[model samples]
Target: MSEPLPWYKHFWPWFIVVLLLGVIIKSLVALNIAIDNADSLVSDDYYKEGKAINMDLRKIKQAKNLGMQFLVKVEEHQLIITQHGGPQYKAALQVSFIHPTLEDKDFNVNATADGTGAYRIALSNAITGPWNVRLEGFDNSWRIQQRVVINDDVEYWLN
Candidate 1:
């Protein structure tokens, strides 16, 4: 009777299989290392630190642009005021807008937060020119004054 082939003697098949597996594993490891190193280069702590250092970056960079998710967008031909913050500010929302030209007269509107740190106020009548929108938070005692201009035309949309 012919002797059966031993497991160790299956050189070509085993070598090919092991080589393919090794290549795949090496590629996976390289990818994982690259991802890990990239993540480490810009860690969450570093991001948080950057934001902390520049307080107005988030407000200006995110809020200044239209179609921001969290920032409120004022409609065209209409003036809108919004207040946004955290849980402690649930009780009250006060926003006041005043045109620099009209110093004594200011449009004041009280906004209601929908328990999501976002509040919106719409002016019934349209107002124009350069204005200042001041937002005051009840809980954290935070205040943010944003300058905005309302043009007579062009509808505003938040995406």
Candidate 2:
């Protein structure tokens, strides 16, 4: 038999090299993806956030103690709120619509008293998605918030 060909001429060696190169390339692509899509929900100030959460819990408790209940309605281009049960809230309501992922889509609507315990606000844009609605008084003493999916439904109850 002729002298064995060099190792570089063998099919198995070339196949191994190709697989190793493929793995290296795939790993580089994964590294690039990892760097691009880093976790963003991690807060830098954990202690401060924890303390603030306690404060929010207190505010929520206050709202519950006051027996605040609201019925939010979406009518075409206007949002209507009725405090069906409460101590007759007279203050203007500050409603916050928070998007779970997109910060740019987050907005706030200031609803003024329509009549009696009812409030109304004109929506500047049509909003349809999963949103966190935070209902708070103008003075910001208490807050009621919940995750809701806004669709064609006309009425939503917040307790």
Candidate 3:
């Protein structure tokens, strides 16, 4: 009879080894992805933040009582905001752009009104996707927040 082949030289052992290696490599890749892209939407201090909701609502109420309205538009890299019926705010407006999922992508811009409630500021880059925007007075006495999706051609109304 012909000599039998050694286990290391056999086809079955090599096939089984390759399958295990593939699973191991795939698991390593998945682990790397999970570590790098951890979730950022949850707040660490849930109790404190929850208690602060009423304060935020009070600010919104102040804005509403003052009849504040904003018309927001994005033109190229410029963000244009016009106040409709707010007080003659002497201080600059602070517009916050909060990314829905990624905290690093959030930013703020300050724009001075042109004596006619018209304000403009240059954005660092083009922004897309969903966002939570907060428009606050310079002293933070009044504020309004809303969720908006960025589109180059769309106009947003905030109150």
Candidate 4:
């Protein structure tokens, strides 16, 4: 033993303590940085909008008593829009088609009324692949908009 450590001359104890504190501080800083990065990745508004789309998809598949399902011919894609409710409707129904690949191409079809609140709309060579059909209507102060995806491979039936 060369010499005993004194109160102010002991370097080993202070070094070990400083090292431990540095490690703890580094870990805390890393955790805070990770949390901040995750929050910047996605917006709250966009997350809510995505949830709305999921809910719309679920409601469309469960809808009953709409109208006859006709083959949407490319040359004469006829969409028969039928409204089932009491009394005559004053508002005009809007029919829009959204293409999966080309999102900007929006086709608006005017629904033709056929007595007893039933309507029909014809679209020509709109889109080829799968599509999301959106049916929108107004009930008093409430706005009802239903979405249904139509694909070539998928078949959905109320079972």
Candidate 5:
């Protein structure tokens, strides 16, 4: 009869050990990645931000009262914005493209209205994924917000 094999030489034990080690290594890698890529979306001054909600609400109310609406279209690298009904002639409009994840990717473009209610601004760079667009009068009297998922080109209306 052959002598009994040592536990280390057993196939089942070694297989179990290897499987456990692989799981442990994978878990460690995932934990390291989560720690390294910490993306915090909350502002440092959250209290002040919370207090400012009332002001934003007032601006939104003003926009509603003024019957403000916008038609935004993105083509190539140009952003065309048409005011459906608002101030007859706005000197300047503040358009902000806010990236949901990366703050550094967020950018603001100031557009001047033509004689008509149409405004056009050239975008220096193209953006991908989801973005929160905020449009407000330069004086902050009225504001409109819209969320868009931009793949190639998009057009939408904000009311």
Candidate 6:
């Protein structure tokens, strides 16, 4: 009769042990990654935001009642805005570029319309990625919002 091999010297036993250890190590690594990269997609004041939805809807309705239409385009580092079928006013419009996840990257500019209905603003840097664009009249009587993913030069129309 032959003597049995020790557990450490057995190929089948060591192979099973190594396989289990590998799975454990991989799970630990995945857990570390998940802990380090916490999601920040939720706002801290989500309740307040929910409460303000009605006000935002009212603003949107005001814009619709005024028959507001706009054409937004970028050209040579400048933002061009053309208004159509909107009430004429001599006030600078407020244009806000809100980053989806980063508040520090948000920017705002006041665009004054030319003698015609066209407005222009010079951009010091290029804008890319996803942005929530909010355009409001100087009097705050009307507002329009749009979500745009800017990959390259493109045109956006709001009505």
Please tell me which model should have the higher lDDT, number 2 or number 4.
Answer: 2
Model 3 local distance difference test score? 0.88
The residue-by-residue lDDT of candidate 5 on 1-159, one tens digit each, is: 999989998899999999999999999999999998887786899999988998988998998888898988888888889988765646688999998888889999889987775799887776667999999989988889878887657787887
Judge candidate 2 against the unseen true structure and give its global Cα lDDT, from 0 to 1. 0.86
Using Cα atoms with residue i matched to residue i, what is each candidate's TM-score against the true structure?
0.41, 0.75, 0.85, 0.38, 0.72, 0.68
lDDT of 2 by residue, 16-117 (tens): 999999999999999999998887767899999999999988888888999988998877777788887768888788899899987778888787886565
Which candidate gets the maximum TM-score versus the true structure? 3
Q: In lDDT terms, which candidate is top? A: 3
Model 6 reaches what TM-score against the true structure? Answer: 0.68
Which is the better candidate, 1 or 2, if ranked by lDDT? Answer: 2
Q: How much is 79 displaced in model 5, in angstroms?
A: 0.3
lDDT of 6 by residue, 77-149 (tens): 8888888666765689999999998877889998898887688888887888899999988888788998988
Q: TM-score for model 5?
A: 0.72
lDDT of 3 by residue, 1-159 (tens): 999988999899999999999999999999999999988887899999988998899999999999898989977788888877777676788889999778899898887987666888888788877999899998888998999998895789998
Worst window of 10 by summed lDDT in candidate 2: 114-123
Candidate 3 regions off by >4 Å? 1-5
Off by over 4 Å in 1: 1-70, 76-89, 115-117, 152-159
| Superposition-based RMSD of candidate 3 using all C-alpha atoms, in angstroms | 2.2
Q: Which ten residues in a row have the lowest lDDT in candidate 3?
A: 82-91
Pick by lDDT: 4 or 5, better one? 5
By descending TM-score, how would the candidates be arranged?
3, 2, 5, 6, 1, 4
Arrange candidates, best lDDT first.
3, 2, 5, 6, 1, 4
**What's the CA error at residue 133 for candidate 4, in Å?**
0.9
> Per-residue lDDT for 112 in model 1?
74
**After superposition on all CA atoms, what RMSD does each candidate show versus the true structure?**
17.2, 3.0, 2.2, 10.9, 3.8, 3.8
